[model samples]
Target: MNAKKGNTKLVLLTVAILVLGSVFWVYASFSLLGPKDLGVEYTHEDYVNALEKTGIQIEYEGMTGEELEEYKLNAEKKSIHDYNFEFSDYEQKQFTLTAAESTALLNEIAPGFWWFDDLQVKVLPDGTMEGSSTADIKRLKEDLYSDVADDVPLPLPDSLNIYSKGRVSVVNNQLSGDPENFYLGAVQLPDKYLEEESVNTMEDYFPRIYTVVPGLEITSLTSNSNGEFVFDGVIPQKVSVTKK
Candidate 1:
């Protein structure tokens, strides 16, 4: 190659490397900015407010890293809740829940207003639960708005029976505990309702609840001992970010 050509190629190569490096650096820097740099910063209060809006007092049950550290320095006794690690680790938040809290949370995410005739939760020894709810599909959908009821693919039957129950594990966000186990309620229907299209549409339409929380993935559900629906999945990330 000619001397001038070789020189031109070398300059172009250097510029290309610099451009790529600059682009990569910008991306890396932005990734390191944490939640605060994204514009509006959300405190714990915002999370509480959101929960309150749902008509449930889902309490915040974990201490922040700074509070935890300070408590360790001042306390005379250290229990499970106050244990301090020798090395730094990500702080996990675990919110304890009652049956009412769990029911409210589930209803909040359920499409339309699915009122349960009898909603109950039996807290297990390991913080998991056995939940059962008796829902009268016909009664619940009676007052449903035209637009809201239209979204559901199947027509609202004037009279229908549905019994739903499940065993599940509820966990807190950012915590080292088990991921949330949302067992879809086991569905029971009359034999007459077992026709092909009815079965297909009813099965698909009834169990169609999806979690909208960011960074949460729900796995395929399997039947438990009682042939109830159960899925293993991570709890929703509680950290809320806003763009200012």
Candidate 2:
């Protein structure tokens, strides 16, 4: 009787371990365990096309190695006040950006900042936007801890797969939207966590269009079934980004 009981217990323990392992595997597979493939591919041409639409120019020709790095570092230090905005042939126009273009633009704007990697955005047929990225949790915790109270508990993993889905709107030249779903790895965050004013909108993610294009007025901004973003706006002219 004792021998039979021992065998049964061993079998049960093995089964439990197998079940737990399977569950964790499933969670890791779907969660942000690594970078997600957004299905949109971009090339150098795509990047150039998207950059041109932003009206910013980068001059790094004839410079390589430390020289190029120094130039970019200096540019990073510049504020809006430092740029010279020259306007000509001011007018309102409609612009569109495809998913590939949008992805390229975003990556260019914030490449590897905050330990964010493989960032991508997708627009579904229903105009729902989904964004995903892999983040280094340790770096994020350090950054957050510096600003928050000492007693604030931040139980976080070493890294996380962050995802968000939402609809976006542009009104009065301001881009704003509340994410319907937000996730850390495979776990969906509670609504209360997403309700915080800071994370609720896209305004913090983009610069004021008017600042880049003086006298700019965005009448409408929307996405289409083809996963393209359309913008109707009036601007003094297309502003260019040039190295000074």
> TM per model?
0.29, 0.60
Judged by whole-model lDDT over C-alpha atoms, candidate 1 comes out at 0.37
lDDT of 1 by residue, 6-82 (tens): 99999999999999988765444322211111122233444344355333221113443355334434433112213
Tens-digit lDDT string for candidate 2 (127-221): 89888877665554453334442443556666678888898778767777767897777677777766757564436534332344566678887
Q: Estimate the overall C-alpha local distance difference test score of candidate 2.
A: 0.63
How good is model 1 by TM-score?
A: 0.29
Q: Tell me which residue pairs clash in candidate 2.
A: 56-241, 57-241, 90-236
Reference-based lDDT, residue 7, model 1: 100
Q: If candidate 1 were superposed on the true structure by all CA atoms, what would the RMSD be?
A: 22.9
The candidate that wins on TM-score is 2
Overall lDDT per candidate, in order of appearance = 0.37, 0.63
